[model samples]
Target: MEKVIKSSDRVKDHGEVFTPKRIVNLMLDQPEIQSKINDLQATFFEPSAGEGAFLVELLKRKLKVAKNKSVSAKLFNTKSLLALSTLYGIELLEDNVEMLVMNMITTFNIEYSNIIQEKFGGKVNQHVFDSAKVIIQANMVQGNTLEKITSDGSPIIFSEWKPVSGNKVQRTEYTFESIINQSGPTGTVQGATEEMDLFADTDFFADLQKKEPRMKKYALCGWTSIYKQEIV
Candidate 1:
């Protein structure tokens, strides 16, 4: 005969899961938000990006706006694709981060490729491929929210990221150069040069404030829920 287990002996699980797309839409579609869209610079931060559902929708909306305005196809195409530059996300789980990154790349590639074909008559080369790759990679960053620190020193953000499973915690610093290096010389080709200057500036705090003076005095903690949690 088997004995029944007591409630005290059982552990409750609160598994991390992706946010539903419908819920994400509702949050983004609030009337107050709709009115503020034009005045705002379009930058977005998702503390828990889980599979990038919200990001994908945001991109679609930006693209629609560009297309409807009769903007130059080249400028609109680049702008639509560059909208990814406004996105930022963090995931606690490595697997989840990888999944989100892959999805982001695939989604952006589909739109970017279509734009290229429509504009350039089916041209396929390193420039187009590299541009698409750069946009996708820039939008998604993989790191634990708990282990990051904001520009200000109020509270430590992303301080809980752990790459290894052990008693001692290890921190990993990732840079654009590191990632490009790992790509193993695939980016270098005669007449296929791409500037690395864009990746050199990783300080979002300075870049954002410079573009919009209203954002100058805003604390870094106000930018995302993760930092808000840290300050509180």
Candidate 2:
């Protein structure tokens, strides 16, 4: 049985209680979730992802379907990455976030390794593994979902990885606030905005509200090389 509560202190302090696997399956087995899991490009976000109990199971289901669709090892790598890109989560505790990331990467690697070995009698592709690491690190973040900010009080940001033509993907960054508010273009690449440039000339107050880059456009790259994210 999975330990639902880490400790009494954790339970009292943070109300840290993990959902059991049986309950997780019951929730996921619902028709709505079943339909989403069937679509490889469909995105899912967990507002309070504690060590990825739900995300991991979701990933396993997606990878299982991806394996069925893959004919070649190359295609498998891309499909697996695409599946990984669709899952996102936020955890308040830093330790939980760290574990979440590790669990995600480990689960991805195991699936990838098994598919490659059984299907192609080959080794895990380094580039694909590196790209998976990048995606997992970016998607699973340590932050308070209620406040939509990291522990440092900065707005949480998430990269939207959209698969473009063929094996290429386009990445766009959005503040969690922007995403939740639906205030601006969420799909397009972010460009200069006067709001982000406010107080630029005042060096004294520069540190008051740490600003993200005014412009963020990453060059279209193959899924395996997305980690580089060469600016366009």
Best by lDDT: 2
Model 1 lDDT at residue 170: 25
Off by over 4 Å in 2: 185-204, 209-215
Per-residue lDDT for 97-200 in model 2, tens only?
A: 98899999999999889988898677789999999999999899898999776786566788899999888999888888778778664532233243454555
Per-residue lDDT tens digits for candidate 1, residues 88-136, read 6765555666778787767666765665467545443444345445445
The C-alpha TM-scores of every prediction are: 0.50, 0.88
How much is 202 displaced in model 1, in angstroms? 29
Candidate whose TM-score is highest: 2
User: How many backbone collisions does model 2 have?
Assistant: 0
